[model samples]
Target: MSYTPPSWSPPGQRPPGPGPRSRRDRGLTALAVGLTLLVVAVTGAGWYGYGPGAGDERTRAADAKESAAPESTAPPSTGAASPRPSLRTPRPVRAPSAQELAAARRPGEAAAWIAADPTDLPRRNIRVDGPWTVGGTVVQALYREVTAYRLSDGAEVWNLTLPTPVCEAPEHAAPDGRIVLALASSGSRRGARCDRFQMVDLRTGKAGWTKELLRDPARDTPAIIVHTAISGDTLAVAEGLGAAAFRVSDGSRLFTVPTENPGRCHPDRVAGGSRLLVSATCALGDDPRTRYSQLRALDPRTGAVRWRHRTPAGRRVERVISVDPVVYTSIDNERLTDDWRIVALGPRGELRRTIDPRPKGFEHCVNVGIGAGLQPCPGVVVGHGLVHVGGTDRAGAYDLATGKLLWGVRAHDGRTLTPVGFRSSRGTVVYESATPSRPGRTFVLGEGGAGKEETLMNHPAAAAEAEYSTMAGRVLQAGGRIVVMPSFVTGEDDRRQPRLVSFAPAPE
Candidate 1:
């Protein structure tokens, strides 16, 4: 028996009376409506799934996990972090007053003096130790001794003599101003070995410790002390055959690194920075036609070899200059070839790049000069993110990082420019005229070669004829203040003496 199905109705409307409509047809219509509703709901969900905020919650969860992780333990690179704070005393900030200037300029008077035998006066650069505050007095090194003097009157507060004559300038005082290391010998000639290494108290001028390194008594040649450096409580001394490290506090030996073959590889020079120690070894044998040079970096704390770089046979590393994570070295062939190259190396002894500093169109520009002799050829100064090469007729600056030439400038008024020093900020370079007769024209050129030429001294005599010595060793700066040693004290005169003169910048 077929039973009549209940009829469906719209909301608020009466149901249609059952007639010819079949129940199967009504059931199929209801099923289709239900499926359409399901499809609409899914489409709505799909649109919301791809919206902008859909993945935000998941991203935040990942970020939270990263934030809760542990910190890294490795030391930061020089580019990644600021340098460790220096322990050395901050430079003295007191600018000389008008009255102090007048007193300093007197012919016979000076800010201070060592008053030792004339033979004992530091013929080389005098090592200035401290304006350290000790018992309310500022104390500094005075060549053969440590002396405390009044800045106002140049009067002596206390004085202490070194154990032996200084072979070279004393190693720079320790960063913390606790101790100072000096290499001492019985005589001054190159053959005179610096057998005694002495540490002096920076504050009290008291002797801390003295250690005499063992030496080969049978050796006849002069003892070659290649380099001496002080950094972070360690003292490193490099010589002809080997390099050694010692604790600066008690003079205890740390470690020594010797050359593999003294006949082939002779260690010539060494340099140190805040973190790394570098040494250069040159090859010397019967074959003068070709030579080899090697450079090695050692752990400053332990004398472990970190890395070694060797030049191609027939070339040698002439000099090494370390400026922390970066090292600048000069390379040349055995015959002293005309073309010389300067190589820059990274902290790991990786080669960064090489630079040629010779002037344009000059074939024999290899006479670069440094130190007291003042030979021909230009000088090279590296600092302030720039490499400055000074030639007799021209000078130029190169980008320190990339070795790209930045600017080249011709000498003004037919005077050759020589770099004396760079300003602490590295934005300005100080140049002295090569013409000794051109006085009153110390040029201060800006880094980018765009600033006005600023004169350091405005005298009328030629540089050589000037009453005072204007050489690099004579012209000194401490915290922006300039000091000029007397010509007599600088040995410009026949008799070398001790005197200090401070100068203020001439008016514009």
Candidate 2:
């Protein structure tokens, strides 16, 4: 579906925006948006610039947005602006709600959540993944089942149960909503190999080809599973020293990652999404046994190496933050648990910049799995030509191109900001923040992420505890609702608290 950029104006503001137009005018929005960025870049305080054209915030933001999702806003080659699914990512058109959010303000009374899932106590601690929003459907997988719900209201849409709990899922799926998931080899979780697989259409609850990934007699063993990522039509699964790509629609093997050397160098981990990357560990010069890790950009369909980047000795690529412009963290082999450095790579797999979160006073979330665990950093929001990092006292946005500090905002007296996503589609960012006893708050920063955050919605105190329960889960805004769900559901009692809750503007 062609993207319908949302028309948004912050609270207490009446800035004018262009009215509905033809495809060409819509495409020109980017240029107009860029001009706006230039003005903000020069005037916005606490912002920084570097490299050629330091004032060209428009170009940088545009480049970052395009790089994250290519051809997102480019005009069609010939046809008049039409609803072309392949041309751009689909985005919902959310109405401005500054008035309602302000008019219905309440001190408490569960004002935060208008809808939620009924609380339940499951016997075991089931591993949960997702809250992925697709075509207005919010989906989640836990134990042996995958379920979808309406984004507007937490109402069930459909459910698909698997023989075994899902062992792996991609961060994003094909533009058409197709996804391949790996299941356990057996019902028992102990020593289960995630070889069984299935493809499902996220939009509809239809299941596609389901089969077990065959281990190559010549290359792979009976064991498998880590992270699964999809670029276009190809899905790549990575494990220890093994990586393979397959056709996304129907489970067809594309290619197997070959070992670089008989035993010295091998594939270690892989990451996918708009790009495919494989990390390899190589032991060279046997006398002292020098070791290092290499990141290789591979063609999603052909499995051909497009480029390779070797890290300094003793540092291995630990987690992949993104693959398009390649963001990752590497640590010294000896200091595996510490010394985490966030790095960004150019399109050519060249090292672009690195940020040490410790010195910057920011922290990233490590949402890795028990297995391959690649592409695991979810703590920071990577987009809009900047990476949003979180620090206890304040949060900062770092330029992905220059790695320079852009702007930092101190947390409110009782709340912490978590950059959710660029929902406004106008360069301003939306954030969800709250304290344990305080109601959740939704706010949007000024255009270019430079101005003070204006409150968009505020939940009532009655829902504070429920909102806090999902603090560790993914928090994002969809269809004008703030969704907060646990990343994983454990056996710990919920005390009948809602596990998945959505907060919307209070009814006026």
> lDDT for model 2, on a 0 to 1 scale?
0.58
Candidate 2 Cα deviation (angstroms), residue 4: 37
How far is 155's C-alpha from truth in model 2 (Å)?
1.0
lDDT of 1 by residue, 1-508 (tens): 0111112112343222222323433443354344334432332211101111202222222223223434324332222112111112212112233353444333322222222223355343333333344443345554456665443344566778875545433234566555544454553433345566777766666777777653444543333333566667777776544567778888888887666555556554455546544444454543434566677777767877888877767655654433454545443442232435667776677887777553342112213221110111224566766766654334566676887776555543333345546765544444443222233234566644534455555422211222222222233334333333321222112333233333334333
C-alpha TM-score for every candidate: 0.59, 0.71
Cα lDDT computed for each candidate against the true fold: 0.44, 0.58
Separate clash counts for every candidate: 9, 5
| CA shift of 195, model 1, Å | 0.8
TM-score of 1: 0.59
Predicted model with the maximum lDDT:
2
What is candidate 2's lDDT per residue for 290-378, written digit by digit as tens?
56778888888899999989887776787787776688877654434234577898878888898765444443342222113565564
